[model samples]
Target: MSKQLIIDFVSEITPQLIESKDGKYKFRGIFQRADVKNGNGRIYPKKVLEKAVAKYQKLIQEGRALGMIEHPPDGKTRLDEAAIKVTSLTMNDKGEVIGEAEVLVGTPKGEILKNLIDNGVKFGISSRGSGTLIKRADGTVVVGEDYEFLAFDVVYDPSTPGAFPETIKESREDKPMELTLETLKKDYPELVEAIKKEAKEELRQEFEERVIEAIEQKVSKIREEVKEELLSDPEIAGAKVAVEGILDILKPFISEGIAGEHLEELKEEIKNLKESLKKKEDEIKHLKEELERKEIALYIEQKLSESPDGDKIREAGILKEAKSKEQVDKLIQEFEESIRKTINEDKEPKGKGVNESRQKLSLSEIHRKLGLPVIGG
Candidate 1:
């Protein structure tokens, strides 16, 4: 079985214990384990194991944050949102809004620098150039190097608790420029529409291929119905033997892209499954035989208890093993006749005939003889 099958079986059986804190079935343990050799003698995927460990660590962190942890780790605590800054925004010549932020370090007024400081938080300082580059297949950078950039200022606030006593000021260097939407459509409309048309054609081709596939599936179904009808007619049976070959033809249509080695392995698996089913049936047959023997023993015991006399029991065919329904009926008729004969002799009848004294011997006894489990008796 595959590792996925093992996980599925575990989840289906005793889901509660294996469930994660997130209320979902988790394979954390499986992921954390080292690669093991499966029954097929192949090593398990090590990546699957590593993934489980990472998920387990994430769950631990979540549990710690939620206070569901029993013993939390003692370490330096880091706040995720402590470094954010508030500032003003201004649109530059390049259609980009520069967020001119300020953070107070020592006082409100300070020197503006481009370098980063250890304690001071710099927010909204850098102005990144905005443009898309179209590279060639030769790995060369695209043309249109006329891109423009913008600059912003960073200021600090010291009123908040634990705030650094330094004011951040960004450098005022290059001014911003813009490439407006109206300007692009007016001058570069041909280039833009050409790209759009190419994309539209590609989408149309993909949709056409899907339509063809759907029609082929409908055709395949119709062919299957006709083949079924031909196989059913005896007059066409001789000629229809070739129609069955249509299945072999269709097999390639369905399994066409499958690798040859994989197809061979699939056929071998079907053969193995047939062999396994045959073995199970053989085991059932053996169990049935043992059940028949135990049933006979039960019938004999019941007959003896009903009529204590030995001669009467022997004449009734009580000890005989009936292999068929006809044989059993004959045995019952003989027992009834003997009981009637005994009654005519004027002696008191022991109890009843073999049929009357019949008991339902549980199949459990047969299962015990065959070393298999039986349903409740």
Candidate 2:
């Protein structure tokens, strides 16, 4: 395979362009991620990025994780015109490379970067690299282990109305290629998540019809078991006797001429009633989802409307992307488990006879008690 030139853009929103007190500026946010498709439709396995980030750290330590104000003529970082000095670079547990870069003062190009930022011009962080490209028959491009990290350039993101949408912009073809994390994720791994996501939402939308049907089938089987249990258990003899008496009365009617015809009609009536109950269950599920959504929107508006940096957080659209939200949720769960283990070591709590002693409450119960969505919808 031919060597490929790769450019992966990081969202300007994920990182803050902090204005330092002494007339300096720094950019900090996620620089890269592993085991996911980058903006270029290239997959870098966790191991691949783990190794790359480890090696790249050495360059950062050397103050050589340099980059220019803009992409150079042929995918190179000319140190003499370097505009950014990467102060720190490290990967998080989720395989995202968090980086900090300071705008260098007393440099011609660096001054230009500072000016653009002051004027509210946004810059997307993009990496310049080269590697062997493997095209999966499925149209996914995998970045091989031979992949290398060059400088993280500051590419200007046009903020004007007519500017290209971030989704479409990453798909552009220059001699060098650029990838937006959103586009590739949407096109590939995320595509799977997107497809299932709606069904899952409808599932959370409450008692999905297919799901209800499955439960009804289970209930039908359980009804026979209930009858057997009731007949066998002496402690419930009253219930068993009542059931037997009803059966004895129905037995004559079930066998006779006019009464047998009436029994068939009664069975049909019961079936219709069951169908009506199913529709009611479906309706109840929908109501739960709707109530949860409205409560959430109202709470956010009333409590967090003026939240600090909420706009940036929302605009960076990190949590809003959903894939990242899934990552955060997993990490949060892992952390909760770790904390529970640490605090209640060797001593069981009273309620569940487990650590933390917290009441095990289903989200639905919690939502019923408080005005909250039952779960992620």
Candidate 3:
């Protein structure tokens, strides 16, 4: 026969602590503890649970972390039997699997669990999983490293020693829920600020990226459409010569020379055409040079304005390369990216990475995440 449902009941959620901080039915408690012998005469080592908790973190983030009202009928987490949305699960320095799960009050099993929390009925955290057991010489059973943490089932009876939440909730008894922003403000003000800061920064960055992406898509489409419309005159991008017709008219005539009186007329015409062509060529050259110079100057301004490394860049030969308009266009695309990035960096709040280490989610984020909204911060 397969292993019986291994329900390691660790703590009881007493009615006295049934306070929902923001109408979100949530609970904070230790699901399973390490190195603590329970009433079942079983001990779970820290190393064993550490690996399990680390593996189980994926489920929590995916919103698949679930629990049953009493216990799971089988090993797999069934959607029909699921009653809790296990959001935040982590191990503290004490080697305890600290967790915060929201009761799924919408489903049938959830309704039952909600009624239990509402009526002040006692419930406890029971971690369900399968693992090998080690029998010590003293007859004490230790949960081995093969332990696979499945889900946290909130139950009524706990078999672990001091399994009551009063033991686990010793530090957080006065608080409603740990993930709530209010509680975070009091306990970890810096982390709370970090959440707000990082949330805004990320949202802004995401919005900017999305907005820029959308604009770029639209611009690209319009650009393609314009290119198609101008396909007949690809040279429209360059200067339009009003006297171009004169060149077309004179070309055939110039190819065939005239004799008699028309010969003198043709010679004068050739002389005049040469001067006109030279003047036009010089004019076009000057305009092109002027445009290219401006582009190069603008490129240099944008590059140097970003940092005080103009001398270094010149010494490195990066800026000494061809400063033509075509090269400037590529440089504008490459180095000007810093302009947008700098603007975003300016909008970023101070102490940005302070909350990066913690895996715990915030209550609003949990609710926003639709739970423990990964819903949390």
Candidate 4:
């Protein structure tokens, strides 16, 4: 059974704006380094990279070093349409493999990719290969010898992009050379069993990590919802300071190592405290409303005493019926108008004195006295 492994690295493509006549963009950077821990926390040893050097050279010679824009190279079948082609590859003294490639502008996909690069779209290179992986006891994984070097494709996914030469140096001390068949059977009988056990344990650990992450996310969402629901209540909203203080006080006891029964008891206590706080808050709100109503009544009484028709307004019970200062002001105005009308009626002549004075005044005299021009004699 052939297991698949993909190694990705950041390859800087230096575009040749003036050197090349062919409208193709040129890129040259380290494609692979030996004995390096890649983004997946796995190391590719020197021997493995050395073996791939010749394979890549052969692919370059046969004019078959082609790769896609974003997708990985199809397995050993090697029948996928390509967007870029590798022209040269050379390994350095540091065991870092550097390569130069040109973006194929002839094909439709290649033209699109070239346009994207020219327009400043960032792209990185990723290598796809097939191989089995060996996980060490220290959690470092090594690619086996069956690894085959495949095409390097242009990708847009952002990753930790840097030369991994330091990683290569560090992996050398921790990871020893691979054991031969004779050494595996004669010297290390437990090697095969350990590998099997480690693989199962690694899978279980990965599953557990995913499950824990999902549970934490759900818990966080539920906590936010509960907080929002608590804040929506007017009584609770006013007591947010007290609630936060209580939560802070109880937070240390709510964590791991506390027994479930004890935790439930603490929760019940907190619940009782919250209810008691809410009841006290309700009492405070009712008292505040009563105090405000009494204040308004007192204000109305004071305003009535300042008015000239205070006795009459108080007799009508308007001051007591008024709900607000504005209502009391309006009632006072109405009472003052009634008092003024009564005074004016008492000051007027009781019999025909007023009617006789009005009849004595002639129509022309009235018009002239009122500063009007009389017409038609």
User: Per model, how many backbone clashes are there?
Assistant: 18, 3, 12, 0
Error of 4 at 5 (Å): 3.6
* Tens digit per residue, CA lDDT, model 3, 95-155: 8888888888789988898887778787877888765454554666656445677778877
What digit string (tens of lDDT, one per residue) describes model 1 on residues 1-377? 00110110001111111334543211111111123332222222333323332333442344321110011122111232112121333333332232222222232121122123323333222211222233223333221222222111122321344332111222232233344656445434433565578779899778756765765575566557656754664434333344355447648755666455565665665555556555655655675566566555554544455553434445434446577545655665665555445344544447755433322222344234333445563
Model 2 has an lDDT value of: 0.60
TM-score of each: 0.21, 0.41, 0.39, 0.41
Please, what's the RMSD in Å of model 1? 33.4
Candidates 2 and 3 compared: the better one by lDDT is 3
Tens digit per residue, CA lDDT, model 4, 1-377? 23454556646554544366665577878887777777677777776777787777888999888888765322322443678888988888898888888877778777888788778876777676656566778787767665667778777763534422212212212334456776545433344566678889899779766865775576567557656755776446645576577668667756655554576776676676679667866765675566557657766766776775565456556566667778878878875665554445546556645335444544454434434456456
- Candidates in order have lDDT scores of 0.36, 0.60, 0.62, 0.64
For model 4, the local distance difference test gives 0.64
lDDT of 2 by residue, 23-136 (tens): 578878887888787655777766666667777888888888889866666665787889988888788889888888888867988888878777877678877676656566
Residue 334 in model 3: lDDT: 44
Q: What is the model-wide C-alpha lDDT for candidate 1?
A: 0.36
What does each candidate score in C-alpha RMSD? 33.4, 19.3, 21.8, 33.9
Name the candidate that leads on lDDT: 4
Segments in model 1 whose C-alpha atoms lie over 4 Å from true places: 1-257, 308-312, 315-319, 323-330, 336-377
TM-score, prediction 1: 0.21
Model 1 clash tally, residue pairs: 18
Q: Which of candidates 1 and 2 reaches a greater lDDT?
A: 2
